[model samples]
Target: MRVLDRPTFDGWLWLDGYQLNKKGDAVTRRELFVQQAGLRKVSTPAPVPRRGGRQVGSRPSGQPPLVRRDRG
Candidate 1:
């Protein structure tokens, strides 16, 4: 039987939801198969849809907040 090799870290990527760390230059078909076998057997929840609304602690939709002038 052919043995599979473990992944080695090469780079990292940051995104809104998750941070992905790429291992090695390119992922081969054999490596993919091995990776799938090594992956944890766990179920994940489906992504939730976004609702139209302003996020909390964010600036208001239109006009900017009042700017204060300093007097010397």
Candidate 2:
């Protein structure tokens, strides 16, 4: 598991390929801190999606919102 990004919270590492823990099995930083463990940090780059990589319900950057008018 390559480090895709730093932990949103300290002591937690996020990998490039997996995004679940949806099982809610992850313990908090208070429970366990593994900063100095076998983990190593490299100046590696984040993974980029091959396609446009737009997320659902996400608007494009810098575009104005649509204006709507109601006719009576």
Candidate 3:
């Protein structure tokens, strides 16, 4: 992602990037609104990992993934 504009006074940031679709079949340009404090500046962009096969940095086998339940 690239910073499209300076951060707002309230700490919101505007970003532009090409993101993969949910099915990972397509890429589209998108604008994102995110908190500036949640972002970290990286000296270099990391390589995009290939999809499928064994999951990288994932939980051990046989362990169920954690799910967040929202209390409405």
Candidate 4:
């Protein structure tokens, strides 16, 4: 997620995000509204380097993987 604009006087913020597919390519653009005080920074793991001609464990082309959603 990226901050698209400066925070407003009411502490509301606008953000931009990309929805990536299995190939790490951006498939959709998303806009988000959030509160400045409610945001937290998270540490993400480094990306794994490709080992061969293609990424390891990646599915074949033209096949979309099923996405599972968990209710918190």
lDDT to native, each model: 0.41, 0.51, 0.74, 0.78
Give the per-residue lDDT of model 4 (tens digit) for 1-72: 887866566888888998876656689999988888999889975665544675655778799975678999
Any runs in candidate 1 off by more than 4 Å, and if so which?
1-17, 20-39, 54-72
| Candidate 2 TM-score to native | 0.20
Q: Local error of candidate 4 at 44, Å?
A: 2.2
What TM-score does candidate 1 get on C-alpha atoms?
Answer: 0.20
TM of each candidate vs. truth: 0.20, 0.20, 0.41, 0.52
Against the true structure, candidate 3 reaches a TM-score of 0.41
lDDT of 1 by residue, 1-72 (tens): 233343444332221223322422223333233333344556754545445666655677696866668999
Candidate that would win on lDDT: 4
Q: Put down candidate 2 lDDT per residue, 1-72, tens digits, no spaces.
A: 345445556656554443324343333333233454557668855445345567765668798765668998
| Ordered list by lDDT, greatest first | 4, 3, 2, 1
RMSD of each predicted structure = 13.8, 13.2, 16.9, 16.7
Candidate 2's error at 7, in angstroms? Answer: 5.1
lDDT of 2: 0.51
Regions of candidate 2 where Cα sits further than 4 Å from its true position:
17-72
Greater lDDT among 1 and 2 belongs to 2
Q: lDDT at 18 for candidate 3?
A: 80
